[model samples]
Target: MADIKAVLPGDVMDTGAAARDGAVLRLGPGLVQADERTSAAAAGVLHSDGDLWWVAGNRRRYVAAEGEPVVGVVVARHGEGYRVDIGSAHDALLPLLAFEGATKRNKPSLAIGTVVYGRVVVANSFMDPEIECYNSHTGKSEGYGELAGGFMFKCTLGLARRLIGSTAPVLAALGSELPFEIAIGVNGRVWVHAEGPEKTVLAANAIRNSEYLDAKQCRQMVKELLAR
Candidate 1:
């Protein structure tokens, strides 16, 4: 007979029952599938059904359902929808409305290759977990090409998670008293709008490393460069 499942607050389990499938049975009630296996307790990584839903009393609670965070890479585009590559599952769906700063809805918005990271907002809502890209919230690029003065710079994907607002001065070498606008995008891109290319290159280089610059340092560098 298959054992029922359970969930507890702590990561460790002291008195979990075992199943014939070899996986540990959780502390509460859950009938295993006719032909399935589970661990005694969730000692290793858990492959959730969608997300863990706990039930019953606090001490003897049950993880009746299994689930995980919904993170995915955008792969293809459809009419007002996106096909994302969610590991181990089919590509998830992303709607145009899901994108922030989008004036229009029910049409194409995000481009392919734009990796969106987010947890499954609706795990059981669909057959698979639903993902809401963190990129969507950053007012992601609605425009496909360059802006007025110049195009944005590209960097490592990790930079997207550590977005520095436009107010923060990054690349110090660009110039001080620039008298121009510089916008840093959270999607690992930089937008510079100055009088000429010389100023643009200088600013781009300094700002590229802006993540390490302090306000005072940025000011000093901008001042020194502008005076040049």
Candidate 2:
């Protein structure tokens, strides 16, 4: 598990993280590399995950980072690609051929307002970020594609991350009660689908309510929800 601690702007981070075998350290959001040192650029919880370090804040607006999965809404069609809003300052470009087995003549015909699950392939300050609906390593969709049905809701980025963790208790608790499918985006969007609209809404609400609950609390909450 990663060690997480609260930090404020300008706080100096452990320099030893960058000194290991002269390996360059990867900085995530709210972190910046200074002259031979790493420091916090925003107020948030600092997280250290191996060679990758980041500070997670409570801001609703998302700053795109490469390799992060996101759920975006198609806003417009631009040339050979579609522009998608991923709750960031700039819309990301999703090329028509970015999908698995896609071609120029046969591409995904997504209409405006369609929700898509993708990964940020190119993220930087100079240009609009680029996203893709296929995993580059396996050349497969791998759950990265259009989200056709169900419901989508926004949560804090922190909650979204927690929901996607391998040991998320809320998901397990809900799963024990009823069958459902979920797609979580690191950018704060969660899509849930169940057998019916009522069950779907119940699952969504349960997850949303589990944000601050402990594991036992989550299970109990789910139990109470199912009973009612």
* TM-scores vs. true structure, each candidate: 0.35, 0.91
Best by TM-score: 2
TM-score of 1: 0.35
Top-lDDT structure, candidate number: 2
Worst 10 residues of 2 by lDDT: 15-24
- Tens digits of per-residue lDDT for model 2, 118-218: 99999887999999999988999999999988999998888987777654799999999899988888889998999899899999999999888888999
Clashes of 2: 0
Model 1 stretches with alpha carbons more than 4 Å out: 1-76, 81-149, 155-176, 179-187
Tell me the tens digit of each residue's lDDT in model 1 across 50-101.
1221122322211212222233457887776677664433456666556444
Instruction: Write down the RMSD of all candidates, one decimal each.
Output: 14.2, 2.0
C-alpha RMSD between model 1 and the true structure = 14.2
